[model samples]
Target: MASLLCWCLEAVLVAVLAVVGGVSGQVEAATPRRELVPAMFVFGDSLIDNGNNNNLPSLAKANYYPYGIDFNGGPTGRFSNGYTIVDELAELLGLPLIPAYSEASGEDMLHGVNYASAAAGILDITGRNFVGRIPFGQQVENFKNTIDRITENLQSVDVAQALARCLIFVGMGSNDYLNNYLLPNYNTRNEYNGQQYANLLVQQYTTQLTRMYNIGARRFAIAGLGLMGCIPNILAQSPTDSCSDQVNQLVQPFNANVKAMIGNLNANLPGAKFVYIDITRMMKDILVRPAAYGGQITCLPFQTPCPNRDEYVYWDAFHPTSRVNVIMGRRAFNGDESIVYPMNIQQLANLDLQPNNG
Candidate 1:
């Protein structure tokens, strides 16, 4: 699974994968009446930012219009039309939809807080185009504040044990590519080649992840970057009407490094269990046979979206449709080594992480 590098970059590559049946399956979340973990603390970009960016002055807002047409509240700042992958994951974990840090308070903070923001990234400069964003460091900083609040309420003595049993889920790095390096306005592309850039991202990410581990995040499900080139936003701009092999090529190293990071963390960190969710493979499945889940559409400004949005693989130019989100959630929750890697989330959740108490 190192690379789809040699494969030809054709729109019909989708058809090719479908015919070969390299990856195919529909995963549904198993309803669990019992909670898998005591809580979940999420961190990432728009892919799971429930509603953190609504009031931000940034242009990455998704609060209005046909955005959340299918969701319960209708446009709750989720990038998708319905449930986000995190929302589905929380449900599968038998927990309520984790609230955004900007909105959650009091008892809501006890379960978890979603610190994901629309334009956030591993690098601080990664999403400056949006003008205002809580970078990954800031998101972790926000979590620190939440931790302090929890410490005050329940006392710091009990907080460590609680956090040890909670799930720390993160799926980021897309915006670092989509919003920064690829943009003409940014200097990131000139500063480094793809591998160097990926290395830089992983380095900073390793620091933040280790910081979380030090703060009592013991169980982790870290999602790797997906098929950036195949998402409709990049596809529509491709010169060949196919996925941009260039963009996908740029992203491969990041996923590889992240998988390596998981192994390093598992070996070195005594009390933590880290699992890598191979979203690249799962997304390839979605794009390989998008028709299996839904159809495709061309976006037009101020236009009403397809009434039957459930049939489209993308909600808009940049994000996956809710059905695809559900598929990703299921894959992360219960998928095998091919997709989840090392170990899947279900096994990670059940893993006995004994406290390092003498």
Candidate 2:
């Protein structure tokens, strides 16, 4: 009887331990994973641009004081006070921040390179106001150059395969609207209506993204245009300091077409995992409830480092504050289907791609 009791106690203890261990295992499993992708290849405008515009003879350059005040490397040409969207995304990916294509050398190209330039857009003439910006086409060319350099360092096939696995981020189009269509000096508006212009932009965008696919990019996280009318720059344009509903309406078609484009790309491009990031919705959410998201609606235009930078959503009339950028990055990284359709960047990164013919 005593032996039987002792055996029963042992069994109960084992059961308890097993239960406890299972709970502990569940807790451990709940922790977030890291480094969903091998590397991140960024291509966009000022939103994700790090320092590509620094050396260029352009008014859009942001490599100066107050720009990188919050960054470890001061004044690294990020338009925001610190940590652009790409910076935060890289941190979430467990990779070091990607260097701008202009500055990246030798080992810098190993992980990836950022070809985004401040004021850059899909159209070559989009940022003509800036005078010397690298448009989306030239950025792609720079990326091709980077690929050649990578091929020289590593085996061409290995580089190609690695690129197939990397995350490709594109966040253009906003500049196309803000710097080209809306500019008083530009004739884009005279040439096309909102619908026609959006269609034209999508047509060009499709070609550019296809070129990226031809060059081996498979996983894509493309950010749609945000609510340009709500930015301080546009808001200031209003005599009553109100948001421009007209400007906001103008870009809706672009966002809609971009969603359609993603669906089409996924259907047509084998091995393509295109995730559409709804910047329009994301920005509106933050703007609508600025207090909840820890953001302010406005900031002084073109001023040196606002002391209360954290409170303002607009860092300087145009760009979002670093805090807002961090929040935006987090949402883009792991947001629900509502914000990031099909999947988020995290999902895109972890998705298994089929064997590519390339």
Candidate 3:
């Protein structure tokens, strides 16, 4: 049955991509450029996690075969089979791929480090099911340690100046909903309605991002929540096998608050360029027409390998394939304001901010 499903999905993706191509014209490619940003510091959850979760005693790990089958280094711990969104973003920015925080040292810290851990969330307790995953707060602390190391190594390098000029990517909050509030065993749902919960998440998120700002992060690329209700895990719960409208609706406010937060941060923070990447819209666009994005709506179980990996939208029940990551990364890098509002990452990276002398 899995094989059949995989086969059908591959066919669907091929057709979808063809139709999408015919209608949308040629897809924009990421233009190679000189180092657009000084560095890219990443935080958040599995979506951007390269390998930080490998050593952690967590169930939310992807450190074995089939996980990095498409990636060159093989099971280096990215959730996807190949390059993550940050990896592609790094390429587009003309910087070397950002190393996972666990492995980074010396010169590796120069291009920035990725503190993203699979199963991480804005709230520390969000992914408690996974156990041992670094929370957003912890990731920030790890980044501070990285800064200390960098300063120690390059005594002449101005850490604050380097950070101010670098790009900070934050993609989180999905697990707070998926692994926390929505879980049957959790009390989060009883305490608050969807709107109230979203407010709570946003409040914590604001505090976390502010901490980053206080620590010298100035350029920000904040990815909004994607359509979690439409993922295969949620779809599997439905008797009709349809996307959960209720679940999808629940997350809309979180995305809205995130966008509002970006505006507020930009207005309040000196020299802060907070660019919002509308992953919600981008994923919906691809999900609505999987073929166009070379993605399959359904993913086979992790143990079962799909022959046409690039054609599948998702690699497992929750994460997108490396190909889809590339697609989304490229869009975030150069897509118009409709997809990545205010400005895309490319534009944000190239933006020159007046020194925050204050």
Candidate 4:
């Protein structure tokens, strides 16, 4: 009886220890919920550009007047009359206004930075017709150089880690087709149709995105081609006030394929989230039904509602107005089943509990 009692006590003690250990392990395994901070880093072409290429000898630049006329009633180097998508995104996040990366006096480095060029594209050859367009490789190099400068300038900085937290916004590829292949000088349309062109562009983009991922970009907002066919520049080619079905046909597949590429990238890269914005469809919706958006049918005289710039389509010929860009950014942030989705930049930022009150 004594021996049996001793054995039973030992067994009870072991069981008690095991239970305590298990509970302790579970407690250690629990992770605290992370609060999302608003730190956007934009890099792309004119649609969301903030004048990174103003000084660069590229014809893709928009540092002149009339571009930012709507911004502060003066040129701010942004391609739009007012704020671009990145600027509005900063406001939505409640962060301070995003400054151009080129600004010598405004290099805060913490809030956000804009590195978009006017006519830059994924392919180096795309902007040949655009006078002085910078290539994707050159842009990437510049981005890296900027990061280095930031690290050297800031004290107690983990340059690699800071970049990981910064949201990378990249929009390219439009010029690759529009100015390079489709322009009168090149016109690859006669050889490779729209689908083929899109595939080529996507392949080039995949390489560039991979390079970015390798360079400490964990958070990304990768925008695809906008309504290139509907732009005033392309539409002017039609001359009859009709839409450019040729450009539209090419653009449709390009957006779809680009979205697919984003999905694939997300799957392949662990913990990488890439959101594709369908600005083409959104732009079309406004153009097809201007009254639905609460805007008039004509923006100016002599131009028909469609021509006059009713809420119908474009602002001038090349870009959307600042208001539309804000809407597009919001939609892109939100995601599918949203206004357009996989959540636009605005909606994604909302998921973060951190303050972005810019």
Which segments of model 2 are wrong by more than 4 Å?
1-34, 291-304, 356-358
Off by over 4 Å in 4: 1-38, 104-107, 153-157, 292-313, 335-340, 350-358
How well is each residue in 1-358 modelled by candidate 2, as lDDT tens digits?
0000000000012222232234121111113347677788888888878888888888787776667777789878887767778888888887888988888899978778999988888999888877878999999888888888788878888887888889999998989998889888998899999999999999999999999998888999999988888876776568876779999999999999999999999999988889999988877676664333232232222344455555456666677777667767878888899989899988888787876543
Choose the strongest candidate by TM-score: 3
**Candidate 3's error at 179, in angstroms?**
0.5
Q: Between candidates 2 and 4, which one is better according to TM-score?
A: 2
Q: Rank the candidates by lDDT, best first.
A: 3, 1, 2, 4
lDDT score at residue 266, model 3, on the 0-100 scale: 93
276-338 in candidate 4: lDDT tens per residue?
766676665545533233222222212221321112233445666655565565556554543
TM-score of 4: 0.76
List where candidate 1 sits over 4 angstroms from the true fold: 1-32, 290-303
Q: Name the better of 2 and 3 by lDDT.
A: 3
- The CA lDDT of each predicted structure is 0.79, 0.77, 0.80, 0.60
Model 3 misplaced stretches (Cα beyond 4 Å): 1-32, 155-157, 290-304
Q: All candidates: CA RMSD in angstroms?
A: 5.7, 14.5, 4.1, 20.4
